[model samples]
Target: MPTTRDYEYLLECANVIGVDYNEAENRVKVFVSQKMPPETLADEDDVKKRVQETDADVTVDVVDAGYDDERAGYEPLSTLEVIPEALEGRGERHRPVPAGVSEINAISTAGTGGPYPARVTADATDEASGAVWSDAVGADDLVRLSNNHVYARSNEADLGEPILQPSPQDGGESDDEVGALVGYVPIDDGVRVDVAARSVDRDRESDRYLELEDEWPTGVRRDGYEELREETVTKTGRTTGVTSATVEATSASVNVDFGEGGTITLRDQLITGYMSEPGDSGSAVFLEDGELVGLLFAGSTEQTICNRIANVEADLGVEILTEEPDDGNGDGGGDREPPVYTTTFERALEVDLEGASLDLESVTFGGRPQPGATVPLRIAVVASEPGSYWVDVDGDRERFEIGGESSDDLGHTVTASAAVPEDAAGTLSVSIAGGRLE
Candidate 1:
């Protein structure tokens, strides 16, 4: 088995800016700049020799792109058509600060705000690069969350330095101060995250993102990168407003160029197609159901990079505040419908027992498949002898024993259930295993 540590060693190659592990394919995708052609990148033989060392079944693929921390400093873009406040282009300032607007250090930089005034947990931090995120309450005060490069200026800003709304680039003045830098997870070699936070008055911010006022980041998704692969993700930002993209890779390693702050390698990054522009840093990434997934920080024309929200919470030592589900009472929690999460390919199968006149009929599954959700299965056995038999579906099995003697006209029905795997794909194999006449 190839460990993640082994995959990180592949970054040692020249011009290899990033790498991602595709668990389903058992492939390691190497992201290199256009300056280096894919052909020149380490081929399968070379990668195996350099990284695999062991007989781990790993393949290598080369992709071309460059990446940078996405912080558009104060430069203005044309106004988009007026829409819902949540979906509006957020370069301009708002009275009550909401996420997805220009917010950054009081210096000359700019990035978007994430979910404001919400209590969020763990992640890293930096300054002067991207958006501020949720309103996680620190020990004594409400904390405004964002990328370290946006709030702490990539570890350069002083604690207690003023943070501004609308960013200086968007004409925010000293009077627009909403918070001050309190802490950040430092960016370093092989850093897992680039997040930071500042203290703000609860009254100065809204606990919601713009253009997504109705949906709160309900919870932080703690599942690994594999869960997010191919899943649809969305972000609201100072630069792009609201945009959606499919997650291309979950366990991606990125070389984030932070301009004057130089470049650094971020591992375990969440990769998405182009859904962000400069000044979109610190934007919170969400699943279709509004679960917080990652914190947007870096990107290129080809891809966006994010710190997984779970990592953010671990590094920042704060819980990301999410809206509580309404219990149909007068108390708190947002009112949102239960989500119908989908799974991979659906399959149906039938089987026959060898050396035993048992006909397994209509081995069918009930309910739409959701990843890891249990679906009930019913298998009817005809002309069955009284025996102990097992039914298998994609390696999971349930046993059924017939108590009566063999009969020609009788039919026995048995119930079994299987939980779909996360990487469910292709056909499902259903069969009788360990069948024996009693």
Candidate 2:
């Protein structure tokens, strides 16, 4: 049998994968949270680490969690709706986030009359997120970035239309002119490629984002598609402030709602946590190191979906600006990475002596100890006064004695052990002064 120390190491490595011990063969099994596809299954190394604790020939098993979003079965329909209904909805704007400020949670709007400022987007009802394409777009020319569905209303939008800031539906009066519509791509396969909206006459930060960090964004890395899984990613948006989550699915196909009950099937999309909310679409996704990863688009109750930021840059023809942290000491104190530790999970066991009024309580490996591991039974007998108690097990007839006669109100708690069997069930009979309990 492997020592508990040996078992503990495997337990750490198993973390969320869950642990299963095969006592007969002295093997401990750990399963992956999600089964990576065959070509990518090699990534399992991310979860399975090479940790050897002892020389005792202990077998460790790794199991795949299997690939499945676990969504209820839905018929693959030839979706009929093409253009999405208005995404912008009526919501009052709080304090105005002046242009040129970093970490600005944005809103979208659409209108006429000299490209008025009032919350800008293709729809006037909802507050969708937007980004700046160029820091210097000719005298405060806000070269904002967004999807054609947002800036153009699918194909219903025009080339030279109004783009407001607080969006009129959200009470962006005609006086809040931010920019005008310049370039955009029509929707194709549920996503708009090469999309950009230009907002002029506004001072702004070069390349910053609404981030979770107390400090500002340092630099931005692009398209970390491969290394994103199981790694934490973050985003700041128009609606849900700042949120972070691990990328769960690398390639997913989903049908999403876009208001007025319209739906589209988006493929080759990355899925992360329940971060982004209604108006977070168009918010940027970044890594802990402040590297831009994806464009926040569609999502469900369980996930946030988006395209690689690399694709966003290539299609839109713009570059994201960044400034890496630099502490004067140059010891890299500004960006010092932290260390990590693993946590173990433990469960307790409970049993009671029929008439003996004795309670057995001990926490072990999920309440059932590994075979060959002793289950220290907390034998507690309630009596008016401490006295002799004889305990005998039914299975093996093992006998033990606890306490010579004494005095105590809470009763006596003595120690006992049982060589757990394969089924992990034990029964005992206890005899005290006046009564015998089984």
Candidate 3:
């Protein structure tokens, strides 16, 4: 759990090495040019001393000049000499400046102002001929040096606009349109109604088909020219946005089978236009008004399948009723739980000091504590002679006198106060513990 400052520092380090973060993969990748090795204190100490003697004036020249278009032709150079007039009276020896030598201060102020930059060369004239005389710049090394100073400054300027506030939950009108489908019932219409019609009669035998006795007529012929009826319904799925479509042209109940061996069937009337995608298989689908409708089980290439709320309730031995209905309000959106702390408790202890005839002054227990969380501690002691005893836990301490009336069969009772430590992330333990005499 890094803070904003920590993230800022990390970003700075990345910029120094020319890298950017990938949010989707949660990774940092090299995004720009290779980073130059940081100039080290030990390596530049002599050069820095020389520059200081010259009143901060210094000049560098590329002994073997070469063109580098990407870096604006600023060839890698070596510090030839420091001609400081201020050190003319000092014992420092003088060295002649080279002819046609380029002034280091004229290049980049960043290179000349601070500590003298490290010189690197790759030509045959450089020491270790045929080898590139370069300094090492590890990923972490570049990040540590560049993040706080360079990358952070650039990022702050680039992101100039203030952060946009999150939209308020109560700002918009509630949409009552069926949000998601849960289940559906079949209507045995000798003539299946087209999807374009707004409404259809359920009681007309020739127009509607019923699957259960509750929806059937009191007296009807069991055999004749029979027609099958089916209904497609949908519900809101957790992962998939919504599920509404059904598998038509099949005599069996609409059941969707995922290629992964999972199946889901609609046991009641399903809402229309519901769809699902991968990863939404186990999502709980709710009705448009936010009622628990069904649990999405599977989906096909063109349809989704969910277990009906009523059927699920019967199977699980529970009631299927709307306990809380959505009021077209948006306040209830978002995940329900907060982030969990994963840090471990490094140490724990319990102490018992009873029937010990000794000078007992005070005691203390110490450990790293979690912020805003309490730590429990208990202390007990006994002594033959009545005296004053003190106890300390964390940094807080208290004293208690135990004599005659104050002494019980259990001896002296000393309780340690609970506390949360300030340095909650680092190792902390009791450094010392002892008791003093009355």
Candidate 4:
């Protein structure tokens, strides 16, 4: 098998624009600029020959737009005349703006919105552009999320600038402004993420995506690379509306040409089929279960490009709040099932007692936990006594008091809460060793 470093060298090739590696199949799909001649890098046979130099067992594949066509970056501009009318949701002003609608910075032309609603971490600074991705929360504010090129005008627009819905091209005016540019992760060479945010006006904030009536992102799946390989994913965008495609590559590096902004290489991108178009930039990409996966940015006629949602949050210092925040009044109180189930561990105390006994029943998580966030760890126990009990969850030792139970009738249940480590991931193993205190 060719090491990742070995295949990375191909990206340096002038004609080679993108690369996808399928570890299971031992296949390498090379996407070369369509402007290149067939004799140079377009020929599959020639590309395969080049692969033989590395490892004969590895398969080499070349992706192109065919003989007469050329592949170019799908700039974030509406080409409604070329797109089928049925697929284009007539760009128009929408109250409490939803995802999959047309939006852009006042200074720029157009692009789709972010997949979900979002806010920036700091105060607004300037105007904005590009399609909104989705509504998100940052620094306790509701902000609109999208590509930097879309919301931040490719890092050109000043902060706090107006962001209009339906886009200026769609007849949007100053009165239609929804938010202002708060901040963005500046685009740079080998940019790992292309994301920006704007403070959403209270009246324009919404959690709905166009076609997905009631569905919304429940969580962010950061390291779903293995699960998404060859899996199906979908996105709702300005030009394409709702579309589905197979995830061709979970890890991709591509050179995107931004016209005057120049060509910059983007690393660690998700590649899908031709499910997007020019105006689809900033659309949120999701798994079938509605987990936010990537943020759509650039693509070609043959494939789509997106920055992983995980990278979007890390680079922007924000979290895509999947659920609504508490109302603070604390009036809404009830017990509900968790949104998702995660791996957990259950263990019995294994110590027998005459009258008083203890058993560790189960440990559960309310939802997907991330670093720096407190996870509500629930521990179920059945005991016969009231005293301080120590439980070891993974490595974090938790001590809690168990009271009001002294029985062998199996009628007593005690629940204790604990905290997981900052680096928690995968399964959570829990064990306990405690007895009734005097």
Residue-level error in angstroms, candidate 4, position 77? 5.6
lDDT tens digits by residue: candidate 4, 1-438: 443335766766645677767777888888765546546654342556667875888888777622234433334333223432224443765554677888888877677788544434343322242223233433456556888888887767787788888777767788667788876887777668888887764323456677763545756887857468778888888778889888877777777766667767777788887788777878888888888898898776667888989888767756676643444221222332232111112121222222346664333445455554555555445565566655554445555666546633332233444355677666443343444444
- Candidate 3, 52-169: lDDT as tens digits: 3533332311111111211111111111121212111111110111001111111111100000001111231233232211133111110000000111111121211111000011
lDDT of 1 by residue, 201-317 (tens): 543355667777465676678876687888999998887788999998887877766656566777788888778777788898999898889989876667778889888877666
lDDT of 2: 0.41
Candidates 2 and 4, the one with greater TM-score: 4
Candidate 4 achieves a global lDDT of: 0.64
How does each model score on lDDT? 0.64, 0.41, 0.24, 0.64
Task: Quote model 3's TM-score.
Answer: 0.20
Model 1: lDDT to the true structure? 0.64
Which regions of candidate 1 fall more than 4 Å away from where they truly are? 35-56, 66-89, 118-140, 324-438
What is the lDDT, from 0 to 100, of the residue 179 in candidate 3? 11
Instruction: For candidate 2, write residues 1-438 as lDDT tens digits.
Output: 543223333323312223334445565544334434444433324333343334335566654433244321111111112212222221322112221111111233421111111122222111232332222223212245554445555445556666554444445654334455665544454352324455543221112342345233344445446566667888765555568888765444444444433444444456676675554555666678866666666554545666666555545444443321233221122332111100111112222344444433211111234445555443333443334444443233233344445534433444445565655534322221222322
Best by TM-score: 4
